[model samples]
Target: MSILNSFLIKTSSVKKICISFFASQFTLLIMMLYTFPIINSQIGTRAFDLQNLGYSLSTANQIVNNLNNQTTELYLFPQLTLLDVFYPFLLALFLSSLLFRLGKLIGKDNKITSLLLYLPLLAMAFDYFENICIILMISKSIEISKSFVLLSSTFTVLKSLLTTFSWIVILIYTIKWVRLKIMKKATKSSLSQS
Candidate 1:
């Protein structure tokens, strides 16, 4: 295999696969580099909030509200294309990859695989809730109020750090186990040939 292929194999575990699926879910918690130069330049020239933008803040914060006011601004990103639309789904995919690794270690059987696949889907639903809160925070549709800035920044940073740590520790070990199994299978074949 080439370098990239080898890299992918080393990282490929059922858990990692599931995490990748979940991480792509951003529709609920949509914010970008929140401070990226691209964002600053793009959303920077203007600001908006639900009220001025002609939307109501969720009282029950129901799923219907989430769907109704997915975007805080009417003209937020005329240039923003389909990739932006699927970004959340893609993010959920990435996060779900980790669950695949978790399942492998817990049990790589058919039962475990089924469970792993479903776990991330559940997580995606929860993430949508978080996104709802984020949508409510865009002040003047410009910047979020301090509370939301703190909520999202703190929640996202902590979640990311935990995810990274889990991948480094658990996923690395799981990958090693898989390699060992493959090597063992190879060894058995060689012995039978002899």
Candidate 2:
């Protein structure tokens, strides 16, 4: 909590920090996109295909059983779930700040603004839980527990929903910000001409 408070204090009014976070997200996206295909090729349909099969012990076991020995041994490398935790963590901070800034641009009421500012934390929190669960499942390999798979799947669903909601809100606020900027510029130009 103190760390969160400190981060909020440090980043609250710093537009550059928020922008940097977005930039990092873009880079992360590219890296993940590139690596996922490579991992998919090596592991075949094990990772993502099983991920789509819903959250269950059966699904988890299937995924675990499908793992190649080499992939299982080299688990943390190239596809580092431990280090990947930072992506969603930083995303929650930067995205919330961006949404809050955008909300204010269109004169959103304080209640709405406050919700926008804090809501991304839900996504981030779930993402961390999901990561932990995935790591556990991976470490266990063929012996992965059904309970862990169920837990990870639940967290994945939650993280997906919250992340989608956060992005939707950000999109709405961004559109509002753009419209407001255009309107304000038009109003100023008219005044100058008169």
Candidate 3:
């Protein structure tokens, strides 16, 4: 926890946050516009990573079977191992930095805010685990276990939930921060006029 706090503090500069955010966005765009479309076209369906609500074991098997039938695991595996691997880390960094900045702006840079900063990291970890599970399922499609499928689905759902919650928290803090900035400007204007 101390290490996490220290790291967040060290990297929460506005410039780092903006860079991470844009990089994450660029990675996402590449995934959405190129990688995902190619894999989806080959498999004739959306990939497992996109299934935010989670998929059943049977569905997992079906998707894997589709990839097997299409022989497109080559395409999917590289995206998961390369771009998807980097994307979660970038997103986590961006969200954590933004949240840290917002906490400081709203004068709430205490233990709670520090703890809240872990949400993105947790989501990223889940996403990584989900990717690993997916890789395993793809490689072992003929003999994929129900337990592995269940675990992967669980990780997917957790990642989705945590990411959504982190965004909501960011949105709330942004509103408060904007309000504070406006109030400060109004106060300054009134004092200057007087």
Candidate 4:
């Protein structure tokens, strides 16, 4: 926690934090454009939210059952998983960092704000676990492991839940931060006029 605090302290500026946010977001956008569409096209409606994926082994098997053999094979393909691996990492880094920075800007000096920055990382960890489970399930398309599928689904749910929570926090802080900045600017302008 202290190490995280130190790291955040080092990056405790709008410019650095915003840059991190943009770079990660940009990378994510590119991945979605290049990788997600292919995944989506192959899986079709099975491309539900990550949370849905984590429902249970029965649900996971059902999703697999729904896909045609070609689509199923494509899902298990090493090439796609390679691309998939990076998405969660980028999302966790950028979005979490963005929330952390925004919280600092809005809440300033609030210890809870600093702690809240870690939630994104938690989501990222779950994402990684989910990816690993998915990869395993895909790789062994014939003899699917129920445990792996179940665990993967659980991780997906965790990732989704944590990410959503972080977004809510970020949204709240962002509004506050914007209002504060506007008020400060207005006050400065009035003073200059006087």
RMSD of 1: 11.7
Residue-wise C-alpha lDDT for candidate 3, range 102-190, written one tens digit per residue: 99999988988888999999999999999888877777744677777888999999999999999999999999999999999999999
The TM-score obtained by model 3 is 0.91
Off by over 4 Å in 1: 1-37, 42-85, 94-130, 139-146, 162-170
Highest TM-score scorer: 3
Each prediction's TM-score versus the true structure = 0.42, 0.77, 0.91, 0.74
> Which residue runs of candidate 2 sit more than 4 Å off their true CA positions?
1-9, 12-19, 26-34, 46-54, 141-147
Q: In lDDT terms, which candidate is top?
A: 3
Going through the candidates in order, what is the number of backbone clashes in each?
A: 47, 0, 0, 1
Ranking by lDDT: 3, 4, 2, 1
> How does candidate 3 score on lDDT?
0.86
Q: Per-residue CA lDDT of candidate 1, range 109-169, in tens?
A: 3553544444434434433433444445542333444555445444333434444444454
Candidate 4 RMSD to the correct structure: 3.5
Which has the higher TM-score value, candidate number 1 or candidate number 3? 3
Name model 4 segments beyond 4 Å from true. Answer: 11-19, 48-53, 56-58, 65-81, 141-148, 189-194
